[model samples]
Target: MSDKITSIVGARPRGHGEAVARILSLAAAPTFAIMALIAAAAPADMLCAAMQGPLSLQGMVPMYALMSAFHLAPWLRLVR
Candidate 1:
């Protein structure tokens, strides 16, 4: 296909940087999930004892789980 047609259809060829970014993007979901799992399973007191104020696994676990859920769309699209 011609460049103009491919561009119009959102199929433009990817560059090296774009490829690298896509790879990193795909890895984001799993990374977030693993972080969330670790936070949820580990002893919260031990993990956040030194942390004061709002700095705690209570906040971080949900954030990481939410991030993992949000990043799952790309993988779902790939699967579909």
Candidate 2:
């Protein structure tokens, strides 16, 4: 999940490295079962605590849930 986001952020589609970067990112997506477990955990407090947030964990949890869904969907070949 993290791998995919970071790769997309760092990759340049205009570059020759595009294929390599995309392939690597897709390869790192977690399996659907594991993804479900992770989403259920919804570890937003830990994340906020770790980051020492100037931001609200309350607001972020929903977004984190959405990102978890985003990350999981790719592995099901449902979305990219």
Candidate 3:
């Protein structure tokens, strides 16, 4: 005697969250380093302009925070 079986598929595998976390965490350091280098190499006037420009300090903090969050959130998950 033989038995028949069927398989069903739905959403594709999104991959392990830990994998995403690891990649993001590893990427964060390099990304920050590059950004820091760029900032350091920029002319004083450019840095001042960026600080005083339309975004202003107030806008800059949130933007940076959001970017940092995107970068760190995965790593935080991995740590947990």
Candidate 4:
């Protein structure tokens, strides 16, 4: 097997590039998740004032949640 396979069987050791990719993938999920949490806890007025115009937790929470969700594939790949 080449140095990219991550399966349980016939898996080869990871190369330097692959290792960096793995590390980044692992880090991305939590980073976005933390962003979502911070967004959820932030005051709506503060966000609105910073961004200008109308903004609310209702809009911000789900958008961040979706961003975090979109970054979850790396975690899923690790599980499999």
Ranking by TM-score: 1, 4, 3, 2
Worst 10 residues of 2 by lDDT: 27-36
The model with the greatest lDDT is 1
Question: Deviation in angstroms for 71 in model 3?
Answer: 9.9
Query: Which digits, one per residue and each the tens of the lDDT, describe model 4 over residues 6-75?
Result: 5532234447566566667677778878888897688767645676544544566667777778888877
Expressed as tens digits, the lDDT of each residue in 1-80 for candidate 1 is 35554443343536655555555677899999999899777875754655635544356788998899999876776577
**Candidate 1 vs candidate 3, TM-score winner:** 1
Best-to-worst ranking by lDDT: 1, 4, 2, 3
Give each model a TM-score.
Answer: 0.64, 0.28, 0.38, 0.59
Candidate 4, superposed: residue stretches over 4 Å from native: 1-14, 46-58
- Model 3's alpha-carbon lDDT is 0.50
The residue ranges of model 1 lying beyond 4 angstroms of the native Cα positions read: 1-13, 46-58
State each model's CA lDDT, in order.
0.70, 0.53, 0.50, 0.66
Best by TM-score: 1
Q: What's the lDDT for residue 72 in model 2?
A: 55
C-alpha RMSD (angstroms) for model 4: 5.9
lDDT of 2 at 7: 61
